[model samples]
Target: MDIFIKIIYAAISILVATLYGLILIGIVHKIYARVHRRIGPPVWQPILDIIQTHGRKVATSHGIMFFLGPVFRMAGGMGTYLFMPVIFGSVVFSNYSMAGDLLLVMYFIFFGQLGMALGAGEGGHPYSPLGIARGLSQMSTFELPFSLAVISIAIQYQTLNITTIVAAQQGGMLNWTLFTNPLAVIAAMISLLGMNMHSPFSLVLAPQEIPIGPPIEMNGSFLGILQTNRALFASAKLVLFMNLFFGGATNLPIMMLKTFSIYMFSVFIGAAFPRFRPEQSFRFFLRIPTLIGILSVIVIAYL
Candidate 1:
């Protein structure tokens, strides 16, 4: 009975997180539209899109891997969110957090993309592999700084348990890692620009010579699943960042506000900055963000 309750609670948590992500992305489209001085689709546009795509008939299978690709991607998204504690003190939203779950969440972030790469490769789209190479290379480069920041937090907190880390930040805003260890926060925030796949870092999916790279051949339900995973993955990343840096929210509204604000940081920056070449994006992360991340770890661990 106790185990069943946990499953029910976790299911609710995931449902809330996934739906919240979908709505937030619709808001993002509106923001981007305003930034470009155009009226965008309604905030419900994303939901309508997913429904429309799913309503279509799936094409004949390309291969087993192709079918499994989006499945693995959705699994990866759920895997990242499953163990994360949502509202810190709320029993309903706490999810199933446990020791070392942070590491697992981090791994799942990459897992979906890797699975997509394998699946897309089987699609025989020539551009799929081309984009995957650039994307993987860029992901590896940006991940360095974010990984170092995670290490710094672990060293500072002396535990891989996310709940413990959030507990320590309780009581006041200054106790948050944002104030306590600005370097790691800085590094992580900059890396987020890449993680969100926004301007200067959107070579793989943005308006390039070959756009919508990996999913270029994906259509119908295949495309819908990928789109859905994007929302969940992006929200999970934002919520993780909020927990680690801004201090975990104790209520749903606070969580929503903080996550929305954090996401807007990347969105506004995307609007302001020009897109970087793939090589340029790779080089940028390897430089200053990497240095700040290293310095953060060194300061937290040794200083």
Candidate 2:
């Protein structure tokens, strides 16, 4: 009965997290529209879009791998969310956080990207591989700084447990890593801008040239699944950042506020800047953020 209850709780948390993610996307769209002085779609637009996409008939398939691309994407998103505690002390929202630590979370985060890359390769679209190549290149570059920053935090706290890290930040806002370890936070936030795939860093999905990039060949239900995964994945990333830097939330509303705010940091930058080429993006991540990440490690080691 205890095991069954845990499964039921996990399902609820995943469902809620997915829904919140969709709403967050809608809010992001609204913000973008406001920035451009144009009327945006309703805040519920993503939900409607997903419903319409799923309702469309898929007339074809590019073999088994193609079909499994969205599956892997969704699995990656769901798995990442499950491994992170949502509401700290809350019983229901904890999910499977105890089953893994920060290292597993990092691997789970990359799992979907690799899976999607494989699926995209199976599509036979020239642009698909091109986008995947650019994405992987950019990922490799950013991962250096991001990984270093994460390691620095782990070393400073002397643990790789997400819950433990958050607990250490309790007491007050100054306890947050964002205040104490500004260098690491800066490195992570810059890497996040690239990870979010927005303007300036959005070369991977260069719609003007690639017509939506990697998932270009996908349509109908498959497209819908990818969209759903996007929401979940984005939210999961925001939550991870919240836990690491801003201190984890103790309730749903605080979680939404912090996550949304962190997400907007990317959106605002993306809206203001022009897109960077793959090479340029890679170099940018390697230069400034990498330097900061290194300094963070040095500071943590000494102090």
- Candidate number with greatest lDDT: 2
TM-score of 2: 0.97
lDDT for residue 244 in candidate 2, whole number 0-100: 91
State each model's CA lDDT, in order.
0.88, 0.90
Stretches of candidate 1 above 4 Å error? 207-209
- Encode model 1's per-residue lDDT on 209-278: one tens digit a residue: 6566778777899989988888888888988998899999999999999999999999999988889999
lDDT of 2 by residue, 152-222 (tens): 99988999999999899988999999998999999999999988989988878765565677898999999
Using all chains and alpha carbons, the TM-scores for the candidates as numbered come to: 0.97, 0.97
Number of backbone collisions per candidate: 1, 0
Prediction 2 global C-alpha lDDT? 0.90
Looking at candidate 1, the ten consecutive residues that score lowest on lDDT are: 204-213
